[model samples]
Target: MDPGFIGDGRTVAVAERSSLTFGVEEEFLLLDASSGVNLPVGDDVLARLTGQASEQSRHEFRQSMIEMVTPVCGDLQQMREHLAASRKAAGDAAAAIGAQLVAVGATPVAEAAVSRPAAERYERIIRQFGPVALDPALCGMHVHVGVPDRELAVQVCNHLRPWLPVVQALTVNSPFHAGADTGYASWRSIQMERWPSLGPSPYFASAAEYDDAVQQLITAGVMLDEGMVLWYARPSARYPTVEVRVADVLPTVDDAVVVAGLVRALVATVTDDIRAGLPAPRLRTSLLSAAHWRAARDGIEGQLVNPLTGVLSPAWELVDDLMSLVGPALTRDGDLQAVTAGIDRLRVEGSGAERQRRIHRAGGDLHDVLVYLAGATTGSVAR
Candidate 1:
């Protein structure tokens, strides 16, 4: 990457309201349940996929776990259809290989010895981020939707900051790490936070400011290049959209789709609000942190920080309030029910963290936690 090129400066070639384009990618762990250890499957899976494209699909993360990508769709129905099919394909591949894909945010066992994904660039990720590099502990979901203009993407990135914690709250699925209870709903969030670039980022007054930050990181060697600066959220380097990376790895495909719906609505709401020339709200990163901490600590059981009043409130109440606040956006994006219902279900049922704790309580064995997750890996489950 040229030190001067902070963003690709790519404008959407065919942006249209009737033709909204969205895509989401989630990471998982590849493990053998009986042994209860990290298993690297990327190489073998990649080789198999390359030989017979009919049975396997490719994931940049390589194949320790599979990633499913959906084509850009005009409506939620189309997106859902593609997601369902993609997920089935991934599940089929996992079964054929005798290794199931586990969707928990952080794997129960992420020891240092696991091999890096087969890529020189990702190896550079290890090089750039250093100890935070092993972020083998990292797993997340990222959403991308196209925009007509590049600046609009930058503006959307700025405006979307206030609501990121909402994404953080809705997808807190990782509760265990390396056979021990880490006590964070999404241990991956805390683990990834160890990276220098993790946390609330500066609000870019313009893409120029965004570019400047990238340039500075490159100059300081803090980042190998723009790609290394994986702030909680950032404008996608390869696409003409802002990529939101705040959520943990959701357990089921439905949870993944629901979180995508909310994030897509939130982004469009912020974008449309900008198009109308409304005064931008002051998105407080500090307030966002408090909200994030609650999501990390209590998951669905505890109160969340209100984005407006800056006070803690019950998680159910906050979820209701956010769904209401983003109603217009949700409706405009055709994702209102899916996002809201998913939130309600999660609020009522409990977070993955809570479930893991309950399973441990009942069995009085940590292996049972792993055993359950192993079985849970192949199939989908509601929160």
Candidate 2:
């Protein structure tokens, strides 16, 4: 059976014309506070969370990671507050067990051991994937922006394809892996490429086309379910939002807020274009995949493929193009100033991957990189 298909009689609810609500889900690595080694204690950390924190947090595929999700937020400020509180809550819980909740895309230190929680789904994944599941776990950030319905969500994803590489460049936080420099800005993204059903989503003309693609993957044993699509962006099956999963987990709350605000504005801009009867650009998935790889390799430090022109340009120039594209929507959402300031900071300080490399170059080791991540995650370090 095709799980992605929605019956024709189902009514779809459209979002209001007001500001679109959005949220973020961040996955963090649990590391030994002193030794910087990965710790497989996700269940213990969850047990320490109380009340709302307990409700919002959960374990990931491996015991060395935990994920925190913020409630739906109406504006960027509200999103910022919720993200900060959620990070603090989760960080505190991890600290209670002598573990540090580090906002890193990949574990810097080698895993002493790998353990999967006793969940049937996770067990099945490990059984099916074998060594791939046992590889050093990677962390990522997913931004959910409210959309009207599945059909519109699919169209929005087409519009979103051109910008995914830019978004990935903005949040490249994983540079070191297994206590050594990997030379790529987002090693987590590289690790994820090992999956069979991962990379840029194909451009779909309607909801039915999207469903058909997912069904084909399932039938071919490329994916176990619709939730396993693993595309850079997709119409989330469980939510009424298009989930953008291109970014690595950022190193700081401020960084997360910046990405979230930009993403929301991008969605708003694209939704308006769709309403105005603008046709989505038909860029090939192969070209998008190449652009994505360049973003993962260079981050913001070098050149990037401008998806609009299919040419190589300085990364910041492409970033400027993105800002110009989403400028009006940012203004409408009252996020222009904050988003501008955040981009400026990223320009001055560099992406999280660059910052990690800087710390390592300053007579520090990978353990020092972990310390910086821990402090940055809790807002205790200066950007």
lDDT of 1 by residue, 1-383 (tens): 11111222232332445234667766666666565565677556545443223232445443455554555554567666765665555555665777666667786765435566668887777766656665464567777776646777777877776667766877787777777788788887887767676675557877888889889988887777777667767877766666788787676666677777777777777777888896556667778777777778777677777766787888777767667777987787667777777777776666667777889889867677766655554445433
Give the poorly placed runs of model 1, Cα more than 4 Å off: 1-15, 50-63, 371-377, 380-383
Clashing residue pairs for model 2: none
| TM-scores for all predictions | 0.87, 0.95
Q: Kindly give the stretch of ten consecutive residues in candidate 1 with the minimal lDDT sum.
A: 1-10
For candidate 2, what's the RMSD? 3.5
Model 2, range 1-383, lDDT digits (tens) per residue? 11112222221222455477787889999999888889999999999889878878877988999999887777888878977888899989889989999999987887887987888888777777779888998999999887747799999999999999999999999999978999999999999999998999789989999999999999897888898989999998787788999999999889999999999999989999998999999897678888999999999998899777789999999999999999998998889999999999999999999999999999668778888999999887866
RMSD of each: 4.2, 3.5
